[model samples]
Each structure stands twice: as C-alpha cells, then as structure tokens.
Target: MSNPADLGVSSLVLQTAEGGDINPVYLGIFVVYLLLVLAIGAWAYLETDDVNDFWVYGKRLGPWLATWSYVANFVSAVSVIGFIGAVYGDGYSIMTGIIFGLMLGVSGLYFVVHKVRELNHVTFPDIIAELTGTEVARPIAGFVLLANAWVYLIMQLVGAGLLVTVITGVPYEYMIWVIGGVFILYTVLGGLVSVAWTDLVQGTLMVATVAVALVYITLDLGGIVTINQQFAALDSGYVAPLGDGTYTGLAVLASIVAFFGTIFTSQATIIRINATDSIRTAKIHLAAAGVILAVFYTMLIMLGAGTTVALTDAGLTVDNVDMAFPVLITEYVPTTIGTVIIVAILSGILSTTDTRLHACGVTTARDIYDYFTGGEASDEKLMRVSRLSTIGFGIAATAIAVNPPGTIIGLYEWRAVLLTSALLIPVYVALYSRDTPGKAVLLSIILGTAFGPGWEAFGAPFGAPPTFMGVGMALIGLTIGHLVLKGQKETPAETAVGND
Candidate 1:
C-alpha cells in the first residue's frame, strides 16, 4: 500500500517530489484564483448601492446565473471530498443521505415556490416574520440562521485551511487567515451579486472538471462493470445495497430529515428563491440546479467507486478516507488536469463559504439589528450595517476555526436539526393553515427549536433522531397554543384568507 503521507503532512499538502520544497505551481494557482475573486468583489461593490442590492441583487437575477449560483454554493467541498470519501468507505448507501436526500430536497423546493415568491420577502427571517405576523419572528428566525451559518462558516474555514495546507505544504495557521480573510473581504465587497456571478464561473468549472475526470477515470478502470467486479472481489459488502450495515435504516432516515430540512428551511436556500427576478425564474433556476446536482452527485459516486479499484491496483492506501478523492487525483490523474480538479474543489469550498458568510451578515443586520432599530434605518445605514456585519461574522468564524474545540462535524449535523425542527412546521402552517393563529406558529417555532436540542442532548432515546422529536414537540406546542390563543389573534394566513 502507498504511504499515509502520500498526500501531505500535517496539512495534507503535497511537496515537490525532490527537496521537499513547497510546490510553487499550487501556490501560484491559489494566488491567481484569489486575485480574480477579489476583482469580482470590487466590481460587485459598484452594483451594490443599498441593502436590497447587497442582499439579493435587488431581486434581479435571471435563471442561468441563479441556477449556477445555487448549485455551486450548495455542492461545496462536501461533494468534492466528503461525498467521494463517503462512497469509498460506505458504498452507495451513503447516497441515501448525502446525495439522494439533497436531490429530493431541492426538487421538493418546487412545491413551495409559489408561496415563497408570493411573499417575495428579503431574507428567510423576513419570510418567517411575515408568515408568523409577529414582531419577534424576525429575530427568532435570525438566531437560527446565525447559529447554523456561523458554525458552518467555521467548518468551511477549517476545511479550507486543511485542504490548502495539504495541497501546497503551507502552514495550517497561515492558511486559515489567508483563506478566511480573502473570502470575507470579497463577501463584504460583493455581497450576493459577487457571490452569484462568481458562482456561475465556479459552478461551470466544477461541472466541466468533474465531468472530464469521471469519464477519464471510468475508462481508465475499464468501465463501470469492471469497477463493480473489483469492488465485490475486495468485499462483497462493497457491492451490497446496504454496505455491510455501514449505514442503518435509522441513520439513513435521519440524514434524509436533516438534509431535507436544510433545503426546506434554511435562509441560504430560501434566499436563492427570493432573489430571483421573477417567480418563474425561481422555479426554472431551482429545478435546473437540482438537475445539475443530480448529474454531478452521480459522477461523484462513480468516481468514488472507481477510486476503490485505482487505489488497490496502484498499491495506495489512505489513512483517512476523506483523502481518497485527492489521493486518487495525485496518483492517477495527469498533473495539469489534477491541478485544475484540486482548484475546483477549493472553489466549491469558497463558493459555499461566501454564501453562508453573506447570510450571516444579512441576518444580523436586517433581522437582528434593523428590527431592534425600529426598521427605519436609512438605506445608507442598512448598507453600512450589512457590510460591517459581513466582516464581523466572517472574522469571528475564522477566529474560531483557528482553535476549534472538539469535532466541528457535530455543528454541521446540528444545522438541519435546528432549522427544520424549529421552523419547518411554523413556516408551512403560516403559509397554508389559514385558521392557525400566528401565536400558535410562534409557539411551534419556540418549542421545536428548544426541544430539538433537548432531545439531542438527552441522547435521542430509542434511537429516534432529535430532529423528528423536535418536530413532535413543535406540533404539541402548536396544538396547545392553538387551543389557548386560537381566537385571540388571527394568523397572517387567516387574514389573507379573510380578505380574499
């Protein structure tokens, strides 16, 4: 087997084959890419004149740009590194959570597109507040967005630092600041305009590179049949539907809920829909992104399966499976092509990081700060606050990434739980349940978010996922509140219905 250090040392970066010097090629590539995005940021700044322009490009994005932006932002390095590694370790079963769940979730977004565009709100928190008809709904949803996004931002910074360090032999400490500071700078400058436009390029790069890589690797391994034969030869479980129980029914189901909930409830996804130039654009772009992701994730799975055969034949072994994608590239891919693939992976990481970081700033400025300030802050003041919040949130996430305590993966898992459990029912009922009081929805959000974490903390008794338990608690809260406050104040939905 190949060495554990084949990829890189502490940073998992690769050095020159001789003299162990840093690879100038990789370093040069990193610098050029950074400069390009920074340039885009500067241009996006001109387009950003007010809070509307900054947050959602004044709701002017068309289908192609919107589709690519959502795809690029959502895919992230998880597809590049984690998903491949997941398939490598657990076989196709991991797809139930990571790939299929995301696919279904995005497609399912269509069901609510009409309601989302009808409201035509600014932020996800704005939707929550508008739906709930409560002054505090904005801040409550803001907290959810901030908590999830901030931790996710930290994870991206952590992952990027580690990835760059491994690829270039740069010090982990230095990479964190450079990567974090650069993205934050651009995020502050460009906002969503910068993010959406740059993602068009990034998303295309991702698809083209992966498409080429998947084809080449599959042919190299003598096609899919040969690859499957090799998998079964290594371990029958590898070819099994369940992959030797690597993922249980409960686990797979949990993943579906978490992933589904994320797309269903998160500010990040909702912002994409709300930012479209028209409701039709929202529908077309979301559906397009989902289709692209379907093809993209399928390629990743095939690549993962192919790597299994390639590594074995090359006598390569990865100490950590997450390194499988990079390992395969270094060992099997040609230098020029492999270099582009690596950069594309990094691009995936940055695309998502910038989007989430942008969400953080928007949430804080609009949902938190503006709400407290009587919602009359001048466009000038809101713009200023939005930029400042972007910087503040980005820097904070970076600082935590520097000295993160324990495993950060837990933070990623908690995101969907909080977003979906806490807000899913509330948002839906607010949209559809005409007779349900706004206070009932409010109670649902509070109870669901509250007990969602409580169930998680209590160890998810009987193996039930905490997210579902939180949903149950939320339903209970809704019922109780509906019974008590049912006639006190009509819901926003009810008021709309009454007017109709």
Candidate 2:
C-alpha cells in the first residue's frame, strides 16, 4: 500500500510544474553536506570509550550543544511538514495549539530536568526503576518508550522520503533506503556523540534556512504590509487563528492535550536531558529550545499563511495541501538558496531520526536486556548490544515507513495519545513521589494503557480527548490502589552508580 504522503497528502498537481526540475549544482552541495555528516560520525566513534559514552556521551554536554540537540530533536520534519501542511490546508489557529503545547512541554521539563540528571541513567526506564523500586518498571517504561520512538522514527523516515522526492524527483522507494541507511550508520557508529554534534550543525542550518525563508519570502511579497494586505483580501476565516471549520472545540482541546503529552512523555526529549552535563545545563537547554521554537513556529506559520495567499491569488488549486511549503520553495525562491533550504529541511528530519535511533539503542540495552538479564553485562558486551539494537530498530522502522498508516501529523498525534495514556503519570509519579505503591503504578499503567485505545475503539465518551481519559483513569487507579494496598515501602537500592 502506498503511504498517505504518496497517495494524497503530497500530490499537489502544481508540484510537477514547479518542483520537477532539479539543479546539478544544488544536488552536489547536498551530497557534500551529507558526506560531511558521515565523517563527523566516524570522528565520534573514535572518541567512544564504552557503553556509557555511546548511550549518554559521558553526560558532558554543555549548555550550547545541549540546547541545539534539544531544539533539533524537538523540531523534526514532522513539525515542519505536518504542522505547516495543517496550517496551510486549514486555518492559522492550529499554530496556537502547537505553540502553547510546546511551552507547556518546556515548563514540564523545567520541573524534571534536575531530578532526571541526578538519577544519571541512560534510558527513561532505568530512572523509573530507581524511583518505583520495581524491576518491572524497566520493561514497562522501556517498551512504551521504544514503541513510541519506533512510531515516531517511522514518521520521520516517511517525511524525509517524501521531502527528498519532491525536491529531487528521486523515486520514494530508493530515497527511503538511502535515508534509513544514513541514519543507521551515524547512530550505530558513534551513538549519542554522533547524534549530538550533527544536531548542532543540523539545528543551526535548520533555523537559519527558515529565518532566511521568512525574510526573503516576505520581502519578495513586498513587505509585511503587502503580506497582510494579501491575507486581508482572502477569506476571513483563512486568516483567522481558528481554522476554517476544520478544527472544532473538541479537536483543538485534543491537540492541546496531545502536545502536552508528547513533550511530557517523550523519550526523545528525556534522553536528551540525560545527556546534558548538569541540572543547570539542562535548564539552559530547555530555555533555549523554548526561545528557538517560538521564533521557528512564528516564521513557519507566517510562511504557511503567506503561501496560501500567494497560491490562491495566482488561481492555483493544490490537491494535497501538504505541498504548500514545497511549492512555495520551488516556485519562488532562487534555485541555489532553495536547494540549501531543501537540505536544511532534510537535516531537520534527519536530526530527529538519528536521535530516536540512538535512543532505541540506549533503552534496549539498559532497560530491556540489562534488566531481564540481572544487569550483569560487561561494558564491552553492553556497547555491542546497543549498536546492534540501533541497527535492528532502524531496519524495523524502515519497514513500517514502507506503508505508513496515516498522514505524518496524524501518526504523530496517535503516538502522543498512546505515550500520554500509557506512560505519562507513571513517569511523573516515579520521578517525584514516594508514597505511591509499585503495585498501584503497575495497575495504573495497565488501565491507562488500555483506556486510551479502548475509548477510541468503543467511544470517546463526553467528547473527552483520549489523553484526558487515559490520564484520568491512571490518576484514579493510582489513588484507589494506594488506599486499598497501603503500598509497600521501597527498599533502598542505589542503581544510579555507573550511570553517573
């Protein structure tokens, strides 16, 4: 089955007229850029000492690199393609939901970063086991983290393939293989070091490219004055913050919850936090990410809105609204710089993909294999397992991307709903509370995991978001279980030893 992007989401007829032609000079630049990425990975591998270095890079990331890593990981291709498409196709109001959601995520991170760093574990599940005093929490947190990561990695791969195809006219199938291989190579080789440094490069380019686009595009359209006048000439609903009848009250509310869930429960974000050097550094990273996202999203929203006005004024109709940004780049921007923008966008997606792939390795080694095997693996043995796991997971994600289940944004939302429902409260309770019994946690995990999908299958009663229902069910289960069981006190066990 063709993926959603191939089937309909990116099938803008104008793509042929506008994006079919490719410049050899631009392709050459992109190829050189990719080659540089691989070279960096090889250098990172040379510095790798053990499994710890591979997983968390010795927890030595300072503020700037950490900030770039966090920003790059947070702003993936899904955010660009999925979000821009939604804004273009619908109304500008979706931007509000995303912006607030991101801010909420940053806020949650502020509260947890210090504790997370102190725990000093490579994967989230290791931290969970520390606080919950139950070995089972490892697999529970690990499985959900891995599952959510896989779904998201696949979404990124799908987005990467689509973006490559639109820009270079390469066959999507071929592009998928190339993209997947490149991601696995960097992640499997150098681990977090490779992912982090490359992110520094990728994140800078990503933001610069977007900032340039916003300025260049705005100037080309005459000015902010001209852009606003153009917007004013269009349908009022199109320019409004609320979408054009597509995003209802319930849908907007659900998006808000979903965004919060994504940030709060995101393994990718948490893993980045664990990689930072200190609590102070982690907060700096979070604060910087918030600032970067504010600028990035503002520019992106304006670009999407401007694209809509420009395309409509030209009397062109796009079959798939997701092609809005691509069409704008192809038709308007100068060829050389446009090629650079394409690389920047491609880098944004790759940055996220590589992070998740590295995360899969860390979680698989620390949480799943080490926990089940009594935690006795040698560092050499552990490093071997982690690299192998990264490769294995990368292949699995590629297979799923072959026939993606939904649009980029939809798949992202589904993953967020599951993560929030299954893992959010458990994670929070584990990190911050001591009174909640491990038994209660286990039961809450089961119910919260079941409730979200169950509600989706039967009915989402009272128009409550799946995340809302799942979180509520978890809170209630945790409370009742605590009362009935009078939870067992945790045994003092220092598991954060080597992790630090």
Candidate 3:
C-alpha cells in the first residue's frame, strides 16, 4: 500500500465540501449492520413479556452465548478505543492494567457469580437488599449503580462519537445523537435479551475482525520480528516494557486494582452473570470470557503499537492517539476490509452501550421505582417504566456526551474505581456474613463512597488509589457498625425465588 493520501478519489468519500472523502462503501456497510441490529431488537421486544425477561434474559443462556456476551460486554469502547489509544500513545507498560487487573478481577468474579446466581437477584440492589434485609439499601445502591451507569454511558457515547466522526466525516456532536438513539431504541424495545443476543453476534464479529486485521498487518509488515525491528529502528522505547515512563510502577498497580474492582462489581456485568442458566454455566463461561478477554486485550494493545509503526513508516501523522486505529484502517487497508474494521469498532462501542442502558433501566425500575412504590406495581406497569427509564437514561447520557468530559480511559477509571469501592465491601458482607446488620451495610457503603471521592479530592494521598482508601474505610465502618449493633436479632438468609 502506498500513501493513503494517494488512494484514488473513488476509494474515499468527501469528508467536507473543501477536503477529503470517506468511503461510501464503508458507510453502506455500517448502515446494513445497524439495520440488522434493529431487526434483532424487534425480535427481542416480541420475546420479552415481563421485567425478568427484559432484565435478565430469562436466565437461559448457554455456555457459548454467555462466553461471547461476557467478552463483548467486557471489551467495550474502553478496551478497544480508549485503552488501545493509551497503548499507542504510551507503550507496553500500559498493557499491565489489563494483564493484572482482569486476571485477578475475573478470577474474583468466578467466586462472586456463584453467590450472585444463588441469590436469584435481578439487579445489584437486589443482591444487597436480600442480604442486608433493608428496603432502603435498594434505592441507595440503585443510585450508586445509576451514577456508575450514567458516567459509563457517557463514556460510551463519547467513544462512539469519536468513531463515527472519524469514519463518516460527520461532526462528533451530530454523531453522538445517532449513536445514542440506536442504543436507546434497541435497549428500550427489548432490554437485556436484546443486549445479550446481539453481544454474541458483535463479539464474534469483533474478534474475527481483529484477528484478520492483525494477521494482515503482520504479514504486510513482513512479520513480527521485522515489525519489532522496524519499531526499534524508529524508537527503542517503543518496544520497552515500560514505555516512555508514562505508566509508573505505582500507576500500573493502581490500575490493576481498579480494573479488578470495576469488572467484579459493575452492575452491567453482574446482570450478565444473572442471565446465565446456572451457576456452573456462569462460572465456566465467565472464566472462559476472562481468558478470551486477556488474549483480545493483548492483541488490541499490540494493534495500537502496530498502527503507530505502520503510520510512522507511511509518513502519516495523527493529531490524537485515539484516532490511530480508525486512521490506520481507513488509510492502509482496502475499502472493504476497512469497512469491516469500522463495524468491528462499532461492535465494541455498541456492545457496552446497550448493556449499560439495560443496567440503568433495571436499576430505575426494580431498585428505585418499584422498591419505593411498595412493590405492588403491575408487571406491565413496571415494564413500561423500565422502557421509559432506558430512553431517559440514554437521553441523559447523550446530553452529557455532547460535551465529552475527558479521555475515555481517564473518565472510566475515575468512576469505576469509585463504584467498586462503594459497592464491593457491602456486597461481600451480604453474601458471606449473615450476622452483619443493614445499618452496618448502609454505613459501610456511605463511608466507602465518601472516602473514594474525598481521597481523590485531597490529591490521592500517598499516591494510593481511592480504591484502597475506600475499601479500607468501608471495612472499618463495617466493623464499627457491627460492634455497635451486635445485639440486634439477625435476619435469616432469604431464599431465591427460582431455580435452574
């Protein structure tokens, strides 16, 4: 391939009246893919008759579907776009977070899922409430879950906007609405059933696309050894274990802990676990997804490095590292192949977006609305509220996304670490300690939640992450609250409603 700037006019579409063109064929492929997604959403809507089906996919997922869905949900725009961009901008050391974070994080989830499924809960709040035996815990956890979802949703929309704008030559502000609307439509219509099934398809496509892209790029550049030699020739640091000193040892460690916290406790992921047909199935598929994600993330990080090397060789320059993958595909690959890569990027973005939407809806309907409304609302009415909440949340995310807060990785890390700190300890107590009181659980969440943001506001004392302080505060609060309320009668563990 020669300079992408020299590709024939017909191979690209006009980006603006005054300048470059985008490939129409690429846009055509994108349109077709979205239509297929809409069709799937319609099918899911017809299948969903109640809140459980909407929220948990009727708990009937097989191992393969579960595995793919889990991977898809885990590798969202954050992994493919944000983290990959960081790898390109930084280096190999950036990869440590996925390596350490996911290995430990997903391992913990294996234990957590069995307990989660045994609880037979529909949302994160249900898990906390069931164990703590407090109605107030439901809405409090719900609010935290909603806050997490809201920030996460904004992150997805921002990534989507970046992708669509770069690929289609449209402005990001216009692109976010289109992206948000599509997510809202599918999620509002069909809920988690729609999200899970579509994830299977999106996951497969993304993996296949990356595999093809990697193989092609490697072969085109001569081979792995040659690519490494070329990178060393450009800059020895490009191949260094700790690239450019951007990610210090402490930063990597904190990222690992934070990633672990996020994956194990994210409501979107918890719901994916709940969607499994059985606890055994959830464990098998989740573990498989972890291994698969580790591999995919490794490749994605390399892909970023590969893009940088290729661009350096081609004499191309990107203003932002986040733009590297998109620019690489559009400039270096054939239009048809580039189209597939574009869809792959969209697949990563949309997979996470839909699940976040479902999570917000479930939190709103089950945890906040229904719990506060005395739990007597009709299924039909609750389902209606769920649908409305999905749309509402989508709109809110889009509004916030119109002005992106920051880099996808930065914003995601800030919010995820906080949620993990606030939610993880309370959940651990609920699942394992039958003697802990609701008051203690509630106080722990409050203290943990407060400590995370407060520590960050205080400049992250000792260079320690909020996760350490937050979880530590939560444990301390838990012990004190338990000691203070030790004489209260213990609540019997509640039985889950359904079985495999």
Backbone clashes in model 3, listed as residue pairs: 13-21, 13-22, 14-21, 15-20
Q: Order candidates by TM-score, high to low.
A: 2, 1, 3
How high is each candidate's TM-score?
Answer: 0.91, 0.92, 0.91
lDDT of 1 by residue, 160-191 (tens): 77667666767767788999999999889978
Span of ten consecutive residues with least summed lDDT in model 2? 1-10
- For all candidates in order, the CA lDDT equals 0.77, 0.76, 0.77
**Superior candidate under lDDT, 1 versus 2:** 1
In model 2, the number of clashes is 1
Candidate 2 lDDT over 334-424, as tens digits, reads: 7865876786687788899999998888888888888777788888888998999999999989877766666687677677778878877
